[model samples]
Target: MRVHLGSDHAGLDLKNHLVSWLTEHGYEPVDHGPFVFDALDDYPVFCLRAARGVATDRAAGLDSLGVVVGGSGNGEQMAANKVEGIRCALVWSEATAKLAREHNDAQVVSVGGRMHTLAEMTHFVELFLAEPFSGDERHLRRIGMLGDYERTHELPALPESAVGLGPDA
Candidate 1:
């Protein structure tokens, strides 16, 4: 697997660490980086590139994924999500990491550098990379709805059970 990584100053340490770790684990790591820390650096600049790398690689039929990091990881996640065809998940725990891949089919993951220990964050990434999408009917249907909305800019119709269940109803 090829893992693309990006981060702001706050996440530089973890992002660098992941590069080495990914390589040791037999995965190729592509760093879309700040290279040197700058406190004013923007997450979007690097995160978008990493996300785009994953999108491009996958579109070309290669297996690839992305990891974006930041102080809270919120902005990085938001930035990566802006790329077309990229499903980036903000992961905080083992379950979220696994679910990001298994349920959401996320090709990118975002982690908060200030939120967890080095080992914990690394473990989450490890789990994310190892898990496979479930491909269950329900999961595929939900993913399809999201992809459809992304391409069409039209909201999906409310389900029969949800149509009349709002508070005003």
Candidate 2:
């Protein structure tokens, strides 16, 4: 699998570690930014690029998933979710990681560097990557709704709209 990665100063070390680990584990890890950390560095730059890259990869039929990291991972998650076609989940545990993929069909995971050990992070990320999204009808429906919401803020047009089609009835 090919994975996209990025981080700020707070997550720099962990991101570097993940790059090697992903490669060693047979994943093509793409690093986004902050090769040399600067305290003032921002997470948006790298996070956005990484997220877009992964989204593009899947769009281009090259890859399927990605992992993003930062100090709290909140901003990174928010940024990643901004990408079209990316379902990004902020995962802090193995179970959540698995559920994010299995239930939410998350294509990308966000990890908080200050929240857990390297081993824990690795475990969560592995679980996320290993799990497959369950294609259960309800789950698929919900994902579709979310995609619809992302593209068009209006609620899905329904047969109910026909009820009021007659003007001034």
* Candidate closest to the true structure, highest TM-score: 1
TM-score to true structure, per model:
0.97, 0.90
Off by over 4 Å in 1: 165-169
What lDDT does model 2 reach? Answer: 0.89
Q: Please provide, for model 1 over 19-121, each residue's C-alpha lDDT reduced to its tens digit, 9 standing for 90 to 100.
A: 9999999999999997998999999999999999999999999999999999989999999999999999999999999999999999999999999999999
TM-score computed on alpha carbons, candidate 2:
0.90
- Report how far residue 164 has shifted in candidate 1, in Å: 3.5
Say which candidate scores most in lDDT. Answer: 1
Q: Candidate 1, after superposition: displacement of residue 20 in Å? A: 0.5
Over 1-169, each residue of candidate 2 has an lDDT whose tens digit, in order, gives: 9999988888898899999998999989999977997999989899889999998998899856888898888988999999999989999988899999999999899999989998999889989989988899989988998899888986655456576675523
**Candidate 2 at residue 124, lDDT?**
91
